[model samples]
Target: MEQKFKRNIGWLQGSAMTIGAVLGSGVLVLPSLAANMAGPVSLISWGLMGVLTIPLVIVLAKLSTLYPSAGGIAAYARQAFGERAGRITGCLFLGTVPFGAPICALIGAYYLGHFFLLDAGGVTIIALGMLIIAVLANYRGIRFSGNVQALVVIGIAAALLASIIAAWPMVRKESFYPFAPNGWVPVGTVMTVLFWAFVGWEMICHLAEEFEHAKRDIKRSLCISLVVVNLLYLGLAYVTIGTGVYLEQENLTSLTGLLESGWGRLAGSIVALLGVAACYATIHTYMAGFSRLVYSEARAGNFPKWFGRLHVTYGTPYRVLIVLGPFSMMVLLTGLLLQLDMSILIQFPGSIFIALYIIAMAAGIKLLPPKSISYYCAWLACIVCIIIYLFSGWIGVYPPLLAGASWLFSRQRIRVKNGAISG
Candidate 1:
């Protein structure tokens, strides 16, 4: 008998759910950051990121088309190379969970704090609690998780569209006159941050095992999600930045600020409520994906069986969720106790994931067979990614080096002859 995995996910369910996972509070915040760095001309950075991101997305699409296994990039790399390479990919993949998931929880909590007047410690406590609830919801079953994701994602997209529509007429034409006030450095920095925004395309590939029709649906879902994400991002930028709202107010850190300038206090608060809901949805999305990563690692023997086993009735990795909840709670408490901004602490870990993404794009492309278009696009993608990587300000991520060293020390080293990591 063939071993079946999570089988309820269809194209609509998968695409909408995947988009929910990818889009986050970044949408609420990144526009101002981009505009601040490059003025209205920062829209150019959107084009640049789309250029870089599309090729990588294509490579991932090709890989998922070829191999729709739950292992995701780790499975693809392992088939091309060997166990050693696979382990490295898996480790790097797992590493992002620690930072990314907790960051989402803390960020969502912060926004909720804006309304409740929660202190930093109180917000952290609430964030940790939210993380736990999100994880538990997943542990209940994939059906509940998928349904909840679909609802929240639909709400998120609708809320974002409503915000843009409400604010469109208020755009100041003169605000866009002095574009590029800063320079390209901030352009690169903001792009680096936005890089995280386009990240979850490959994550859906990991659910290749879960989707009912893995091969065709996986590729379709990924491409569809990519197009949808790009469209939303571009639309929001025009509504918020093209109108000169960013220039006048100089803040995109919250929908509250954007809405107030574009609309009135009543409308801004309404949008903020939507933003908070979107953030919570994002928080759950983070836990769902990160829990799966834990399940992936545990099955690989890198972690204990406790992490691998699913809940008997729900068929979800309950243990992994349990463990992750407390750890993220600690992150919340520590962030509160030390009075640290979640973004500051998150930047380091987030950079490492971005590095993994660049490497995944490069490696994914390099591993393809000749006579295929993806092979050529992969190398081109790699070169572009390397350029982005240099400008990405992630040279000292610390984790990749330590990770690379650990891989080198434990077994055979990947000989980087002529700048390629190979055996």
Candidate 2:
């Protein structure tokens, strides 16, 4: 008997999951990195991305209402275009899991190292452990995972609020001088980095089938998460600039310094724990989303069938989750051995996501009613995606490479089918 996903997610759970996915490690690190690149004017990138997020989420949410499936953006692509396009989009999205998920886990590990004064190797070990824990959480199924996500989201919100409030009085006006020290070009450049924070909106469409009332709840969740996420982003960016925490600590641990300066060592310790939880929540949501996408693609005969199986008892995509565990460990280990910078890991996926969004929004234009409000929104989103992709610099080369890989896979699949038929 084949198992199907359970409709255990409501609007609140959907919101929590969406929030967790979008508000991940980027919040902890990107502000400082952005400040480093563009000075205080980096806030412009944050503001621009926040405004752009509105239309992107709307196009995705509207699509989910119309075609909810585990395949997410790929499903929309399949419906709007053809199977080859769909498969390519799915593979492109899968690309993020390999490096992006582990980068998120490493953020938590960095915070843990900061809080405990651990060495680089210890941080690597903690990162690997965080990936394992995330896989375990998803193995329990979405009902259990959704409940856990809600609590994690609340804690993340509270921690961000507390940090911002405590740091408000310490904000020095002098920090705003020479705002565009690197010129406005870097402000646009930083948006490429900040794109990682906004990457998760498309993730929820993968879980659309699991929502109890996907059409209604999807919109509701988007509305709630958008406001909540943008506010936290802007507030945190303000304090990071005002307190000049970016100038004080390494970008990875800037949040710790921000919290310590505002509250104290105790608050920093508490935030470290919360940062770990926030990163776990991110890993948890992406784990769930990526596994489901693999199952969908495999079920559609785009990959090996071995990945298509769901856990009979839990109704979850257990096989894919199991495979993800090992792959993530390998990425973490390789990152440690090579001493890779987190920004490099982050920029790779940020570029890939912009490419993915461009396709997703194009799918919207094709599938949605012509000139409808959502259709216009899709156009707006697609345009912004293109602009961001241009800002991705050399990283922009990745999308064409992924497209080539997808074409090769499709050709091989066709050859196999023809051979089997002749045999």
Candidate 3:
């Protein structure tokens, strides 16, 4: 008999995993980046995205309750549309993991490098090590990784709180006068960048089947995580602008400077360590979700059947996790060698995620009962994703390109199957 995934996630662990997946290295840098772009008025962009995230989260949470599967949004696409749509959804989401994971790792490593004053090479080495650690944690099984993630979520929350409290006294009334210095246009522009931070709610949908009470716990966890994540984001954005840190230094090290300004130099080091924890937590959850996705796709015959195997002892997708380690190493090394711009790196995968959301929300519209709250929310979410993708610029071409690739891949697999049957 084939081993099945264990139901090891409870409401609290589910909430932590959800939080860890959404609130990552982006929190450490994005507030400051947005501030740099649109000045203090960037807070409007943050608030707008926070509001938009509501229906997106609700639609996804509802979908999880309705069709709890390891295939996640892809499964929903298959159920609502057909096999071709499922393959495209799966491929698009899988594309995000490879690029998104390394970006998170490097951003965390940038925080550490800022603390230790390390060069690019040292930072690349640290990023690689973080990926390996995240992979190993997932290799152990969901129970083990989920527990580690819960603890890391606590640390991440504490770090954000500390940074906000320490920087509260630094707020200047003068900072509010020239809020929209770059005009209101950049507020919308920065939303394109902020989209990356909000793309993670779907990650939890992929693991909904693992929850002890899929319907009850998934709903509870989604509510809990959304509250926690939005509060942290708003507080951090307020401080990043109020303290005028964006004007001083606007990069991954921006959070470090905010802490050092009020708490002391030691606080900078502490935030750096916790930043690494946050990044690992994000990577760890994605690794779990993506590996299961691959496993599910394989079982459906969209991939090589060998990837469908689970670990005999842990009942985890050990084969997929094994492949992730080397794949992550190669991507990180290539990025470092090429000296790629961070903006390009972030925007590419970020656009792919926007594309994935558009399709998933469309799936929700087709599957959910018409005129229900979830169905309405799905419509709103679909419109929101379309708006975001419009802002994706030229990088938006990736989704169409990826869709084409998935079609060709499915066709070739069908041809091979027919040939073997004839033989």
Top lDDT hit: 2
Give TM-scores for every candidate, taking all chains together and pairing residue i with residue i.
Answer: 0.88, 0.93, 0.95
lDDT of 2 by residue, 1-423 (tens): 665788888988889999998888778888899999899999999999999889899899999999989999999999989998998988897678877888888888877788789999898888898898889889988988888889999999998999899889989999999888888998778887788788788888999889998889999999999999999999999999999999989987788788887677686687678778888888888888999999999988887899988888788999998989999889888888888898677777777878888999999999999989999999999998898788778878987898898889888988998999999
User: lDDT score of model 3?
Assistant: 0.87
The superposed Cα distance between candidate 2 and the true structure at residue 242, in angstroms, equals 3.0
Q: lDDT per residue, candidate 3, 1-423, as tens digits?
A: 655788988988888889999988788889999999998898999999999899989999999999998899899999999998898788887678888788889988988897799999999999999899888888888888888889999988988898899999998989876979989999889988898787678888878868889999998988999899989999999988898888787576788789888777687788789788888888888888999899988888787788999888777888998888889888888988898886587777778878888888999999999999989999998998898789778888988898899889888988998999999
**Segments in model 1 whose C-alpha atoms lie over 4 Å from true places:** 1-4, 179-189, 250-254, 261-263, 392-395, 412-423
Q: Residue 423: error of model 1 in Å?
A: 29
**Candidate 2 regions with alpha-carbon error over 4 angstroms:** 172-186, 338-342
Of models 1 and 2, which has the larger lDDT? 2
- The 10 consecutive residues of candidate 1 with the worst lDDT sum are 410-419
Greater-lDDT candidate between 1 and 3: 3
Candidate 1: clashing pairs of residues: 171-243, 172-243
Model 3 regions lying over 4 Å from their true place: none
Score residue 112 of candidate 2 by CA lDDT. 76
User: What does the lDDT read for residue 136 in candidate 2?
Assistant: 88
In model 1, how large is the Cα lDDT of residue 408? 80
- What is residue 28's positional error in candidate 3, in angstroms? 1.7
> Considering summed lDDT, which 10 consecutive residues are worst modelled in model 2?
262-271
lDDT of 1 by residue, 1-423 (tens): 222356777887678767877787788777776776677777877877877777777787788767776567777767777777667777775556656677777777666676668787777676777677777777777778878778878887887777777777776777677667776566776776677677666667666667778677877877787887888787778776766656566353445655675566665456555655656666676566666766776787655657777666777777877877777767666666777766666666565655666666666766788757777777777776566566545545565785776588445433444346443
